[model samples]
Target chain A: MNRLFHLPLSPFSRKIRIVLGEKKVSGVDLVEERPWERRMDFLLLSPAGQVPVLQLNGTTLSDSTAIFEYLEETIPEPRLLPRDPAQRAEARRLAAWFDIKFQREVTENLLQERVNKKLMKSGYPDGARIRAGSANIKYHLDYMGWLLERRHWLAGEALTIADISAAAHLSCLDYINDVDWGRNAAVKDWYARIKSRPSFRPLLNDTVPGFTVPSHYANLDF
Target chain B: MNRLFHLPLSPFSRKIRIVLGEKKVSGVDLVEERPWERRMDFLLLSPAGQVPVLQLNGTTLSDSTAIFEYLEETIPEPRLLPRDPAQRAEARRLAAWFDIKFQREVTENLLQERVNKKLMKSGYPDGARIRAGSANIKYHLDYMGWLLERRHWLAGEALTIADISAAAHLSCLDYINDVDWGRNAAVKDWYARIKSRPSFRPLLNDTVPGFTVPSHYANLDF
Candidate 1:
């Protein structure tokens, strides 16, 4: 069977799981591994020692975006990116926004500090970083709200990887109860729609040992 | 005429510039812009207030990877990505290695600390960060050396975006004379080959007002 090496709360790993789920691609087994464990075998799969490594068709694939693009090319069903090149670019741009920008500004600050630090037995979370992440999330939510006001989805008429990427990051934060859902009605409604998807269901069930799954995290209405 | 809003030292910007140059796609004008200026018009082009935004065919493109993908699709010659999906994934994975991992570990520590701080009038460069970045780059160079020892290019036999991405970040560091060419023979030879290319010439010629270009920066024989 094909296998995936992933961490439960890693936004990148979650992004791939959602993609795989949404595309309805099957026969893959999930292998949860904390990257900090520095398993030599896992390191061989991904030099960066990051999660979301996929073993498909006897080939090993690493990097969330690279894996997503590969899947899209080979599968092409329930298409995640738009047909037009410009629209595809827009979807990718937004995907990068969440993966890079939002990850740097919000997820790294909040989730890494609060969750991964503890899991890795790293030093305590910095209070300043947590505060900065809290502040940064508001701006992101407002930006998302503004975008939703103008379109049915983050990229356009259809839901794309852009939405998946943003939700992936937000879901990790949401698991930690870091997100302020009350800030934007549009974003909340959007999240609710995404939350109801079967692909998202498995993610909500994920539980890290020390961290409690928040009450609203698994709720469809949340 | 088409236009690109870019910063001379930004690796992401340089990546797009080299892609455009190698593809020999004409009619795009370069508009150097400091993203910190927070120009409303520029922000309108990229809400994240980042550089290397491209204006072409009445469409505005942000994110260097997005722009490169668009260029590859619209102008197919001299492909920066491999035709095979698996090879393409490997190329993209390494590209991300430089863009995200190397940038965060090395570039943000060295270039952003030393150059951007001075240009932005931010406080003095953090000594700890500079030290961390300096120590981190050795491992990266070693990793690149290992890869180059096996493959003709960073990704594989073809000179793909993986090489462009790694060279882009290194070129910025090179501008500050931060790269230790003596550390890795394979990486040095690979860089020398890439440096002699027509696409890399303009980057070597770049000059920032407050910093002097290193003598070896533009030397093809170096």
Candidate 2:
């Protein structure tokens, strides 16, 4: 059986989970592990000590984007990237925008500060980082809103990994009630569309021990 | 008629430059731009306002990894990634190790603090960050040495984008004379091999106005 080592709130792990669901790939056993535990066994599988490690075909794969690309190459169906090279690059560009830029600006500040700090007993969330995250997320939402206004999806007409990547990061932020859904109508509508997908169900259902999910978290209408 | 907007010491820009050279994709006009300048025109091209933006085939591509993948897909010869899906995943994983992990832990701490602050006239380099970066790089170099002891290159036998990515970051640090080359022999040997490549020439020749390159930076025998 294929197994995926993940954390409930890790956006990278969530991105891979959605990709698996979208591709209709089955037989993945989700194993939740606290990366801060630094288990020697887990370290052997992922040198960077990150989650979203997939064990398949007698090999372990770490890095969410790498795993997503591997799945796209091997499966080739329900394509997450466009056929045109330019379009594919655009998709990847947007994906990186969320995975790297948005992650550094917002997710790390909000989620890692608010949630991971508690989980690891690291300390209280830094007030400045929280304020920065709150301020920065509005800009990102506006950017998403602008993109959605121009195109049917983040990159173009198709729902690609770009959408998955964005939604993954946003969903985690939403879980912590950090996102202001009312700030951008277009972004909210876009999230609503992606939220209704079956791939997003498992994420909505996820519940961490110390944190309570927002009332609207699992609502499709939300 | 291809053009690339880049910064002299930016690791991402350097990686793309090396990729273009390795692939022998010619006719690129290099335009040096200060990303922090946030020139409205440049921001229109890359919303993230980052460097190494490529203009090719009437399309503007941002994000170094996205650009590299696009180049690899469009120009197949002298492949920077392995043919096998699993091998490709491994290559990408290591590439991210440098691009994402190392960038956050070391490059941002060291280069962003030391070089970018000076270039942008932002402020003084924080002493704490410099010390942290100095400490962190030792672990990274040790990790690189461990990997080199097991493989011919950073990823495997044939040098891939993984090597390019690692070299790009290390080269920048070396340019600042921040790298302690004598700390790891295997890593030194690996850097020597890559530094000798024709693709690495342009990077060695790169000179920022205020900073002086270490004497051994351009020398293969270093």
Candidate 3:
């Protein structure tokens, strides 16, 4: 059996969950981890102490993008990455952008303001930072809207790893009403379709302490 | 002919340059770009205004990792990525760590205080951001020392894309004397090997109009 240490709201963890479900990998135990608490065992498993560490046959893998690629290569079923190298490069590039840029600009802000504060985690919320996040998020959302307008998914017509990465981060923000779906009808529609998947059902049900999701957060149609 | 739009001292750009040289790809015409000048054409090539955009066969690709992967796929002569999927994943993860985490901590500080401040091209520097960058850089350097003690390269024994990514960033900082080589012997040794590479020659020679590199910048054996 494979074991995964994850956080309910972590975008990286959600990327892994989506990959696992898409790949149809069964018998995997998902353990919710509070990384801030800093469990010694978890630290051993992941020196960085970040979530979405996959433990299989005594080998522990960290980093969501890395884990996703590893799973794609190991499983090779319902392939998330394209067989063509150019397409694969495109997927990886989009995944990196979402993981690094989107997370920094938007998701982290929402998490910091909503979850981190509630959790009493490190890093205080500055008004300027939050405002900057909000402003930056609109630009990203507009970019996504442009991409979604041209393709069925985030990267392209194919439902590749890029979609999963974007969805994971955006979904987390959506839960806290950080995303303005009203900003782009195309992006909103795209999210609506992916959000209805069974894999996303668990994510919608996740309730972080002291944080109340909006009414539409769990709505499949949302 | 392949075309590359980049700033000489930009770490991301330097990484691509090394990869191009390592792969033995020819017909690369490098153009130095002034992103802060905000040229309309440059903006069209890359909306983010970040450099290291690779132009091949009428297709423009932004992001160093993406461009490098594209080249690896197209050429695949001297591979920067690992043959094994797990190893490849590790390479990508470490590359991301250097590009984002290390950049936020180390490169951004040195670039701002020592480079950006000197370049009247980018406007005045923010003291608070520079101070934060300096503090963060020391912490990152400490982490690098710990990692170098365990592995020969940033990621593993064999030089991979991660090594290039790390060297690119560190070399930029080295130019401005931001790095304390005496702080960690292990890191210094690792960097010395990287600095001696023929591919790193172009990076070391890079000079800003108003700024000069440190006295030790050109000494490969230093």
The candidate that wins on DockQ is: 2
Clashing pairs in 1: none
Error (Å) of candidate 3 at residue A29 is 2.0
lDDT of 3 by residue, A1-222 (tens): 689999888999999998988888777898989888989999887766788899866667888877887898899988887887667877777887888878888877777776776676655677787888889999998988888888888777788888999999988888778888899999989889888887777777888876789998988766
Candidate 3 lDDT, B78-174, residue by residue in tens: 8888788767877877887788778876677668666766664456767777778767777667777887899888777788898899888888888
List the global CA lDDT of all models. 0.94, 0.94, 0.82
2 against 3, candidate with superior lDDT: 2
Candidate 2 residue-wise lDDT at B139: 98
Superior candidate under DockQ, 1 versus 3:
1
* lDDT per residue as tens, model 1, A1-222: 699999888899999999999999888999998888899999999999998999999889999999999999988999999999999999999999999999999999999899989988889999999999999999999999999999989999999999999999999999899999999999999999999999989988888889887888899876
In candidate 2 the C-alpha lDDT for residue A101 amounts to 95
DockQ for every model, please: 0.85, 0.89, 0.56
Q: Chain B, model 2, TM-score against the native?
A: 0.98
Candidate 1 matches the true fold with a TM-score of 0.98
Least accurate stretch of 10 residues (summed lDDT) in model 2 chain B?
A: B201-210
Per-residue C-alpha lDDT of model 2 across residues B126-201, encoded as one tens digit per residue = 9999999999999999999999999999888989999999999999999999999999999999999999899899
Query: What DockQ score does model 1 reach against the true complex?
Result: 0.85
